[model samples]
Target: MASRRTISSEKGFIEKGDATAFSPAALEKSNIAPAVPPGVIFKLLAFTFAMVVFPIGSYFATVNTIFRGKMSNSTFAGATAAFIANVVLIGYVIVAMKEDQSERLEAEEEAKKSK
Candidate 1:
């Protein structure tokens, strides 16, 4: 069974241990937020290309001398592809981030004008 206790009126009915989160002052603060979800696919693809593919391809490309290395034509081609893919993904992410930022700024400005 759950225990129930009456809160004293002097303390604004806030329960113990809820002082920080349920406080009235905390409820008034807000911020302009990002439009995109945290797990958006463009962001995932960009991060994967930048963090995973780029480094592995770079390692294969530099493991030995360029002219006499064990790296074959296929390996070189794969490396080139990885680098290009990362570049494209990174560019798309940059554009997306900028657009989100602009939208957030505009929203904030409009909100301020209303008040």
Candidate 2:
């Protein structure tokens, strides 16, 4: 039987002896803040949830009620779901563009005031 060598946790094969482990303290010392705003994050999450829920929900709801559980009518249900998803995507893009434009205008006003 071959002998097994035990490696030290502090200095593994890939880790150097002088290297230190990552810690939150290093981040606390930095002056940087998160680049993304909370509102933007919330909007993105909401849109993502709608994209997932609305399409599947519409597909099932339509298939059951409107189509009366007919297999042939599933294609129409699928198309409706796809159209809803596309609408959600377009809405997100429009919101993002408007938000970007507003931010740009605010920045321009700040620059004018600073001059």
How high is each candidate's TM-score?
0.38, 0.71
- Global lDDT of each model? 0.67, 0.87
What tens digits encode model 1's per-residue C-alpha lDDT throughout 37-86?
Answer: 66576776767666676666665565443524444755765676577667
lDDT of 2 at 47: 100
Residue range 1-115, candidate 2, lDDT tens digits? 9997876665664566432334477656766767998999999999999999999999998987898756688898999899999999999999999999999999999999999
Model 2: how large is the Cα RMSD against the reference?
Answer: 5.7
On lDDT, the candidate that comes out on top is 2
Q: Look at candidate 2 and give me any clashing residue pairs.
A: none
Q: What is the lDDT of residue 64 in candidate 2?
A: 75
Runs off by more than 4 Å, candidate 2: 1-29, 69-71
